[model samples]
Target: MSVPAADRGATTVAERAVRRIAERAATEALPPGEVLAARGAAAVRGRRARVSVAVTLPYPTVLDDAGERVRSHVADRTAGLTGLVVPSARVRVRALRVREPKQGAEAAAPVARAGRGRSGAGRPWSQRRVPAAVSAFGCAAVCGAFLYDVVRVHAVGRPPARWRARLMEWLVTHGPDSGVWPGLVSAGAVFLLGVWLLVLALTPGRRRLLPMAAPAEGVRAVLDRRAVSALLRDAVAEVPGITRVRVRVGRRGARVRARLGFGGLESARRAVTEACEEALGACGLARPSRLRARVRTDPLWRAPTPPGANTGSGPAGSPASPSPTPDATTATTATTATTATTATTQGSSRA
Candidate 1:
């Protein structure tokens, strides 16, 4: 096998890096000294990138103008930092605020931005944010404690806090083997935590949303896996023979299963594949998903006939035409079968 020239010198940018760059760019794009907060998410393929940014704006700012600046700046900064061709950035105005208002105190109402993180693809840090935020909070708490103690001792000449005194006393009295079982348990916990963090760092996060190419200028978006599945099913339903469809979308591709109601099995299978592929293309994913469609004819289900189709007795003495099958759309509404036969009749025929 030979590697392509582009693959030979590939430079892969991390999703986390792109997110930070976008967040910084959004903040910088806003008015000087007016930034509240900005968070971003990104999906990058080769040298092309798609990004989503969510930000808080100060009260009484023109939303359209702020969004425009953010979109342009993020696109520019990401391109500059990672050398990626960013077609567009999806900027979401998450809120309007200089500071969060207290309960019962009226402030400028926060703006609503449609959420995109349900599938975790549009989250600022994917799955890493929670762990990273927790670690940062722990460190900040320690720093805050020291800062408070320093300020108190220097400015007011107060004695050390009782909490700190108790902690020191405990450390002095507690030896490594003081609580044998507890010490071993704590050691094991710390080791497990270290290993988990290491694994998280080495592995890529899973995303349940597909990145979409921008349909319009300066506007990229992502579609959730559920939405993709629903779209594929709807598309398959429109096919001539498809009675039911189940679509599963994963990181690698999409798997589709279709039930053919009444048609040549092979032809229906081909139709299903074509329908799914066409609908997927319309989905606008940055990397079009690999598609696999499986089709089977179902004996229990039937496709509905056209509204004007004739159902009549055969010409002359020919057998009467069978009644047309019930409409699929109306079948579910049926409460029970209408036919019932109970009689003492008995017939024996020899052929």
Candidate 2:
């Protein structure tokens, strides 16, 4: 026997409703693979319907609460879209995804531009100034000491100490006989030191800031290297199986170091590399940079605890307890007062 056209249409509607519900459930805050493993079905009897869904989360999720949220959202969306009244939804977490290291690179040129304000161009003054001042002071002190020794010799008209006379006589005899190698090496060392000091004094002591594409015609955008590094670190850390992330943002390239917790190292490397690349693209740097990702497996790895999550006693996935509710009598009294005030204001406005 052939099915009625009305019955066939109803079946098609139910199937679409199930698919839409499953799609919505998988997309919220969860990664791509987690949702792809999800399956959902809907059955309609008269105007009422039931939704059944199963999903596999990549990480440990509070099974009870997460399931409840997904079930509720699915039912609501299905009911609204289809004209069916969804009474209940059944949701189950089939499996937890294995944490594997993922690595990828983003292609973006980092902005390389001069920084404004106090520290600009080169190394900071705090690092270079102290060393330069100390060198200058030491050179002046040595020169002063040598001048005093010469003046003392002229005034005394004879050697102040016999050792000084011996040293001078030794220098006078051996200095000519000594090879030029010793003198050349000493002179070269001194010249290099002087050049270093000069460079330190002249160069700016600031980190290079990465440039970004200008937002407007007359405006310029720049991001600090430290900020870029922090952004990449956080992005890489979000990938599944990654325990720790370290990022170094330079003018020409970015280096990402990721530590894995479990699963295949190759998968983890690919995931992490892709994540880093996405983050770099989002950063919107003007100059494209090479991305170098290194993934290392850490057998003893432990994921960092999120802030505000209790480690001591509460059930997994349960949020902290809310504050106590206000007294019913107080709430009623406040509502009454507000209503009366609004009534009086309306009466006065009419007058």
Candidate 3:
């Protein structure tokens, strides 16, 4: 094979330059900033080529007490020095050159420190105000409704007879009553209101009890098993041709079995199967694959009326509908026997 001229040149200039730089970096233990500058200079002059570059090791920070500790020591020593900023600079181990530190290095450090550090004092208007406003408006509306109810019952109308009569009689018969009961009742009412308001304030999402609006994530309500089962039964009953319906909940999900009771096995299976599929479709599951149906057993199938028992018909009743092919019968029998055995073993274990 012939060698390419470009490959020959790469070996001569780029390979030797990279080797020299790596050797110098290893020997001098040069700081990362100087090393980076050297690498940049190499690329500009076409002395070396880097196909892949990544920091294999991280230098220590002031917060970190382990590692070689030399990086931090160097950073601290050079923090206030002139012409280069070293504290924030990472220790990159590539190419190397040494130049005298510049005159502005010390000033550069503090300015870089202030400019680079993160501060949470001011965020964008959307984050700071929108969520807070939404939560506040929701809470206020709930409180306003409760307060309106209170005012409507007490301050705006004639008080109910029992309490009103007693209060009036007491005020007329006994001049200005004095007791702790009223004060205690007032305090309890205030405490209850405060507790309720606090709960409303801390609660998330919009309040549905009163009319106010805010963008809400989602609304949820509890649908207990009894409610779900009742709904399923009602829906199935409405299917025009279905009778003799049965539902069973199993580990695999839910199994609904139904049959037309009076129809042929095939017809009953068709109607019940379609109804089940339609009912499940309305539930909107993640995928159609999640829902399935099968006709286990239908009571409507009859043993084909004995051959020649009826007045001459077209086929005179074929022999019990031709007992399923021998292979099919054997396979079915084996499956049933296996299933029964497994169930028996499981039941014995439970017992």
Candidate 4:
């Protein structure tokens, strides 16, 4: 079927209007929404049009509420700009932003300040002022202490403060403990702390959010490993006989560690592995990961007690009852009598 030029133009206009609306809604800074990608399509039938939009939000949002908001904005904008009655407006959230720890002031300050123009006014003075103040205070304290110590030592020809003298003495005498083991342990701890801090300072922690192959051109999507792990965990846990599950989602595959309670271990393992694979398949990940299931028998697991059963009692009040007659005493007496009879028979034979 061939479409008329006028109809094609109208559809283009409608799609463009919807796209603009989505960009505006997603870029708004007030509610902290950032649309990493957006797409829109419009269908024009005579005087009526239908618009559909899909957006990837690079942050966590209430999907239902955000979708509704986008739909409303797209419908209104499309109708106003294209002069077509929009009968349907649909919005889908393609991906959620990976949750990451907030970057320190050093990294976030520039980003926050650069967007001031688009954000209307800059953030309140309080937000920008605290970090600067803290830095200034630290510098001032260091310089002031240095000056005080220099003045006390040279200008006034006086001893340093008692605390300062004590600190110096401790550093000179006790700072390096005499024991080699203690020194090694201290050095190792300090080295590890420095390495940890260096890593944190040099690396952007949010890089763990792996980018997924986009379903559409000009669009990008990322999935959080932690979120995927949670999804797999829930799925594996639903399988019968799986009492607990832990899932670690990685770039290549997902590792599932499950505890089986009172069931065939092999069967439980197979069930959980199948369940996890199915769940990951449904997740629509760009690269489907292999499922590695490890099932362990929970030694402490016990069957659920029946409603009215008394678990505290044994079959009898006592676990075991002894015979009333003392068998050990009777046996000892018989042995003693036998020995006496043997001795008497020996004496008779001798006589």
Candidate 5:
């Protein structure tokens, strides 16, 4: 005889299956052409599930609206497919893509703007993974220790935990009327620590990584300051008169110092400055750098004229003549050089 349906075992849905359902739902919520990919994870306990979905979206779209659409769709679809109550659906927009405008239709393309007041230019923060993991671990350890201590003291008929015993003794002995200075000092230290944590939580921490413009709206773009410095070095090296190049990149701007090989001091300085600016611009930084761009020249050690170019170096056009020696005083005045050494910095700020 066959068993009745009532006596049969309950059906179960695997967590992976729930996750796939959520991912499918999230993908379906957006236009097929626009979405690059979608992924999801689900946690199930008893008959309830919590889902999180990650998706790529177009730039300039209202993040809130896009997120909500994905969230609602995932919740409804998961619940309907598995009969599992979905209490929460988290949607993360991984990136924003800027669609290229069709040729000859550039005028019709819409400008991408950062939503709200946020500079769509990304703030590369150290996600606080360490702090969060430490916090969670701390909480778990404390709770477990407390539970173990309780069990040993009550059920097992063992002495209380030493740590707990000491803590209790301290609390019992230290009444409300403790030393004012000690309590006040401790309170002040705690307050300062809390304020410091709050500051870290609210501020973006990766100062060295600068925001850059991406092809897509609010597109995530970043360039390292050290990398920028290297590029500046290469750019200055390319200029004809520069023998040695040094570059320093900071938050405000980049400072470049180039040594002249044979060209006019003023001309070499100008060329170095131009190279620095051009290279910096090409780096595509969203904001300007923090340091100023500067160039310093040492005319005392002009490189020996190349044998090939020296054919006419003798008095300006004699074949096989001696090269005219470089005179520091004959070049631009030190006053002029000093005046032109510093280049004003502008515009490297966080988005």
Candidate 6:
């Protein structure tokens, strides 16, 4: 007999208690003390001395409740056939929910803002200041070490004052004698300028760098693994409509490769391209030569159209009729003029 939902123990405390008792009894009948937990187990007595057990469930897909129930029921029934006296019980449920979907979503939502504030607002400022400080400290340390090395060289190995005089004489003779000191100073200046340029070239930009290419070409950039992963996290969080984003960032150029998922291929491509750029830019990466964003459409994300939708009623077709094309409008005007002339001729003929 079909159990009406209203009569199936939801309406009254007495009925619910009875159902709960029957559920526990039926559950106990099938291999008790096994430490299996039921999310929402209930029981009811059936006619012909049988009990019914139903449970809402949760877990790995391999441990799906439906398959488990089927296997357990079969084993118990087989045992009954072997005279194991498996109680004439039934376990029936339309659906099993291991855990409710809505329960923990709220708890997770606030974490995003907290994380953003910590990293975006707080960490970046610290990162910017700390790196500059470290660089400045490094420069000072280098200068101090160089001065110490010069002093050590002077203290440890001084050829007689005669050697110094000979070296000076060689410079006076072979080098630009009049401007030798200035030339030496200029060379040192050039060396320092080259070192400065090299350092500037190596440092990352203050803004995030996204090196994305057109969809037709693939994206390539050298990036830190952590920076790319952070970008991917942000893309996943901020874009609600996107279904999936796959990001790969390489070292050196911060080369970015991404596969984005959306309801449609076009939208997916667009989102991936935009997200890749934003992520790279945020990390202060320069665009790479091979930056590309590939967009993939997920079959599951296809939007369902209302049944019996009119496909032809888009921009091309309208209930009000198409506006006349330039040629068509000219032809129409010519036809009207011809008709007017014909009417005048007819009137003249009648006269």
Using TM-score as the measure, which candidate wins? Answer: 5
- The residue-by-residue lDDT of candidate 1 on 1-351, one tens digit each, is 998897787678998999888888888987665664466789988879899888888766788887798789889988899999999999888888854445543321111111232232231235688888897899899999988987998899999888878877765555356766655676678789889888877765546766665433344477788998999999889988777888898976999988888866777888888888888988867665899999987877565666865557578656666765678535644523322111222222221
- Order of models, best lDDT first: 5, 1, 2, 4, 6, 3
Better of 2 and 4 by TM-score: 2
Off by over 4 Å in 6: 1-223, 252-262, 286-289, 303-351
The C-alpha RMSD in Å for every predicted model, in order, reads 26.0, 32.4, 24.8, 18.3, 22.6, 20.9
Residues forming the 10-long window of minimal summed lDDT in candidate 1: 108-117
By lDDT, the better pick of 3 and 4 is: 4
What are the models' TM-scores?
0.38, 0.38, 0.22, 0.36, 0.48, 0.23
- 1-351 per-residue lDDT for model 3 (tens digits): 999887775423454444334333322333454323233122213331331111223233222331124334333333332212332323344322334446587556446545533331111122334555775898899788666666767997944456545756765555334444665566678789678656655554231111111111132222223333454556655655556566653322456666543435565556655665665555432223133434444465353354547443347554445446899999999999999999999999999
lDDT of 6 by residue, 110-162 (tens): 46434543222211111455656776898999788666656766898744455
Measured with C-alpha atoms, the lDDT of residue 30 in candidate 3 is 37
lDDT of 5: 0.75
lDDT tens per residue, model 4, 136-242: 69889988987899798899898777867886675555555655565567677878967865665555355446455443334456677888888888888788888
Per-residue lDDT tens digits of candidate 5, residues 1-351? 999996888888999999999888887787775554466788999999998878887765888888888789889999999999998788888898975566655543224432222365666888987777886798899999999999989998999979998877765555335655655676678789778778778988788888876545435878898999899899889988677877877776777777775766667677777777788888977666654555565656564554656544356555665544566554657656665653322222321
| Model 5 alpha-carbon drift over 4 Å, by segment | 1-100, 103-118, 124-126, 168-193, 302-351
By TM-score, rank the candidates, best first.
5, 2, 1, 4, 6, 3
Model 2 CA deviation exceeding 4 Å by range: 1-127, 154-177, 180-185, 198-227, 248-251, 262-270, 281-287, 296-351
Backbone clash pairs in model 3 (N, Cα, C under 3 Å; residues 3+ apart or in different chains), count: 5
Residue runs of model 4 more than 4 Å from their true location after superposition: 1-144, 151-158, 174-190, 206-222, 237-253, 258-268, 281-290, 295-351
Query: How does model 3 fare in lDDT?
Result: 0.45
What lDDT does candidate 6 reach at residue 336?
100
TM-score of candidate 6 against the unseen true structure: 0.23
